[model samples]
Target: MFFKLRKPIFLLLSIPAIALVYIFLRNLSGYSINYQVSSPCACYKCLTDSDPWFNYNISENEFNWWKRLQTESRSFGVYGTTVANFFKIFPRNPDVIQPKPDHCRTCAVVGNSGNLRRSHYGPLIDLHEVVIRMNTGITRGFEKDVGNKTTHRVMYPESAVAVDDNTHFVPFPFKIQDFEWLINASTTGFTGRSYMPVKSKIKTNKDLVMVVNPAFMKYVHEVWLGNKGRYPSTGFMALILALHICDEVNVFGYGADSDGNRSHYWEILTNKGLRTGVHPGSYEYNIIQQLDQQQKIKFYEGLTKKM
Candidate 1:
């Protein structure tokens, strides 16, 4: 009787185990099983080969090459003089301040999606060693959702916001005037004018101001994005930047919300017709999804399943 009972029990337990194996194999069939962590550094050669989406560090020669290309394309403005003058003031790239130490750095790229409102990702996001936020995504009232800590804030001149003293204000300059704007804003509070008016005086640590290289932007557009849309959006640029600086990257609050609308988590949108204009939203989404699937980056899609 003991021998008979043992066989029956073994069969029963083996059923679930066999079923689990089948399920696992089924899911694993099409997926790439090799899980490799991405490197934290970036360079020109690596950008083209391993990951085209990667943003590499730019040299002064590369910067000059890009500017010359832009000049030949007739898209270049008086950027040469403006950038030279601007560098004379600030001189060095602020990214040099935070050198990559001999340790793994986990970074979180936090986007502003309404799905994050109730996801309770604040605690998880704050756990990262480096948290990069973009634009006007504030943490004052939305601390419970977006977290209160910000290590780096990426913004263009138009979307500039006030950051804490400790946070790095990384400016994504699109044109010559944008570079000039940073120098003036840092020192004289903008005595010069441009095509459009920008914030003359920004309240933040001047030393922590890092300007994104225009050459980097060009690389992102032509190489990474394949000149997909009008231009690479701020979020996409920030994502690439994080990949270059952080060993492990976890992306949050990206993609369409639960209702499938492109809206921000911090604001209310009554218009459903509003879409991400001038951006290749669909193409970019597919690329991000591919990155997640490839294990190059970990993407947290903040949506709850309906039971």
Candidate 2:
């Protein structure tokens, strides 16, 4: 009985001793015992439920609904003529958005709000794994405030800009013609007319082009915005896309500037009274603040100085 009790006691005592020795050895080798913990997303389920890109697995109901969305004078063809051709050139699946366990993917969604004019967030923004910029937002003169690095550039045809070879050129298609336009722009040149003066041809690598899913746009309009405005603004859509793809998201250049005027960071405002034409600006601003309050994102309010 004594021998049996002694063996059990010795085994139990050796376990902690072995653990201590292992820790000591790790410390001696300049290795920290710290484990990386990922930040939990509060709305993960909601964000992941809908696929953000058009893929082969898209259900019939979703495809039908997305087809009927009218932007300008065009809608998707009933038999998916443009869509089938689109996948032949562009990738149906976006591999860039895949998440990894060992890596914490941080993203910065940069908008064109004038608030970013003097707010020096360039270095901080560049530190993120993914930096998403939209519309005519430029980094040439304002590289100090807005980082020169860009992972993704989101734009409609009217708001398109030339992106470098490394950056992913994401087109936000509002109508069916937009899909056809992307294919044309990459090949011959998009010479079609629109509500605004669109670039006749865009200069960028075609392989990196990723078109946003129409179903995702409908999801943003109905689920996220509760059918507010004509459709979600490009900036808001970029933010929503970041929320889904990124482990952590930082929002920059949103809302009115310190002067409370709606303007672009790179624009000289001739009309300081200009407001969002079709978007629900006030409602969108409120949702941004609410997300900030909930700790879902880190919202940087730029430039407190009155201009």
Candidate 3:
């Protein structure tokens, strides 16, 4: 009886030991098996590696293509007048704002998922050469998890927030008025307001403001995302932008949180089913997972099993 009992006891203890080892190895790999997903198509590799991922120096032919698409696509009603005004406001391409780095650039694209609440990823995020945050993601109270540094803040008129003089304010214009707003905001303190009525005068330095080409937004939706959703969310567009500019990209606070709720890290909601209506959240998440598996980008899920 003693011999039989000893063997069972050893087997019970070994089970927990094996579980611990599995968790340790998963953490060491910096990716969780839970998030792994296969790509929708094999062409994904070729698409991601293709040239002109961004509108760095958009050629005349590309401009014509974008204009033709704008006329056909009903998602965004970018008028001819707006396109002309956009050109006048921003004659130079996005390359003008790009920094000439002597060495490889490592970028961190920080989203606002609830998973980042107590992640202690602030230090790691700040270590990157370029840090890109979006919309109204605050750091004053959540610095311990989200980091305080901001090299770039990507937003549209509706989600615009004031950045410091040092930080770059990248405006993603969706309408003609948005282009007008940027120019007026920089020059005349923006008396006119949009339908949403954004801040008339932001505190950010005028010279640091960079406007993303509406064409680039179209490229992200059509080419990169394969028109998965109504349109690519700001966070998704920002990720592609980082991939173009940075040598290596690391994503944080994207997808659902620990409990699988679609919510921001700054605010948690009880409704797990809540998701962005306009954006294809599930499809986008799958693509992100595929990119991680392909080693094209690193997706930091935030808080490994140890935490």
Candidate 4:
């Protein structure tokens, strides 16, 4: 019966549906996507081992071999040889040697999930110096994911808002809004898009918000992501923050189940079909496994799924 009068009913529903879509689009809109970047065509020579400070301590023969490998790796189909070169950016403080904490910090990267409403992670999240979140609208029923202990909220303008003194806003420089944040960040770090809005918003002497340069993203991809050179989405971003800032980083509520199937441990609408993470593509499950092996991070794998 609904289909018998299909065209008329379809036209009737379209008006409200169109209005709803417009509202959704406004909410979703943010930085202009960079389309110029194609796949890495040649070795990114800028981030290379040939530089004067290319670890001169290693023997000439070993260094030569390493250089050869770097080039050959690219020729044969390898990427990311420059990941270790970040020390050049911020040379490690040899004076303050030990970075790994005696006890690993349990920092959670909370996802947007209504299921966390009563999960009770406020105090736990507060303990972490940083709690990375994405895709705002969090101040709602999901108390845990958008914990009261929100130390850092990293997003575009649509997501930025009044956080407490400790709550720092780290917005990825994508469009005009980012330009505004950059102006305000005492200091900022950029991976690529440096002309972000944050630059425009600076008025005082607040340090720049640390930016993970696009070059760094490429480096991270090479170091962690396989030769194809694709980067882990925001998951890698969180890991990179831990790698740079904290001695220990604890991950929570990530990954599909043990079956390696795509399913949200978080709740979903009954009418909707299953939706996978918009994060890094591929066996990030495998990548996370490697990160665990290296003791780089600890995943709070749900009790439902285990080793």
Give the residue spans of candidate 1 off by over 4 A. Answer: 1-77, 96-102, 191-197, 304-307
For each predicted model, how many residue pairs clash, with residues at least 3 apart or on different chains? 0, 0, 2, 33
lDDT of 1 by residue, 201-229 (tens): 77777667666665556555554566787
Alpha-carbon error at 196 in model 1, in Å?
6.1
Q: Can you write out model 2's per-residue Cα lDDT over 180-290, one digit (the tens) per residue?
A: 677788888888877788877778776777666665666666655778887788999898778656767899999898778898899888898888877888788778877
Error of 2 at 167 (Å): 0.6
lDDT of 3 by residue, 1-307 (tens): 0000010000000111111000011121122111113322222221122111111233344345544432434223344444445445443333222323234567899998888988999999999878999999988889889999899999987788878888878887665566667767766777775557787766666556666655565556655566787678888888877765665688998887777777788875867788788787777777777878766778988742222
The lDDT for every candidate, in the order shown, is 0.62, 0.67, 0.62, 0.37
C-alpha lDDT of residue 56 in model 4: 15
* Alpha-carbon RMSD, each predicted model: 16.1, 16.3, 16.7, 20.3
Number of the candidate with higher lDDT, 1 or 4: 1
Where in model 2 is the C-alpha error above 4 Å?
1-79, 304-307
TM-score: which is higher, 2 or 4? 2
- Native-referenced Cα lDDT, model 2: 0.67
Q: In model 2, where is the ten-residue run with the lowest total lDDT?
A: 4-13
Task: Tell how far residue 153 is off in model 1, in angstroms.
Answer: 0.6
* Winning candidate number (TM-score): 2
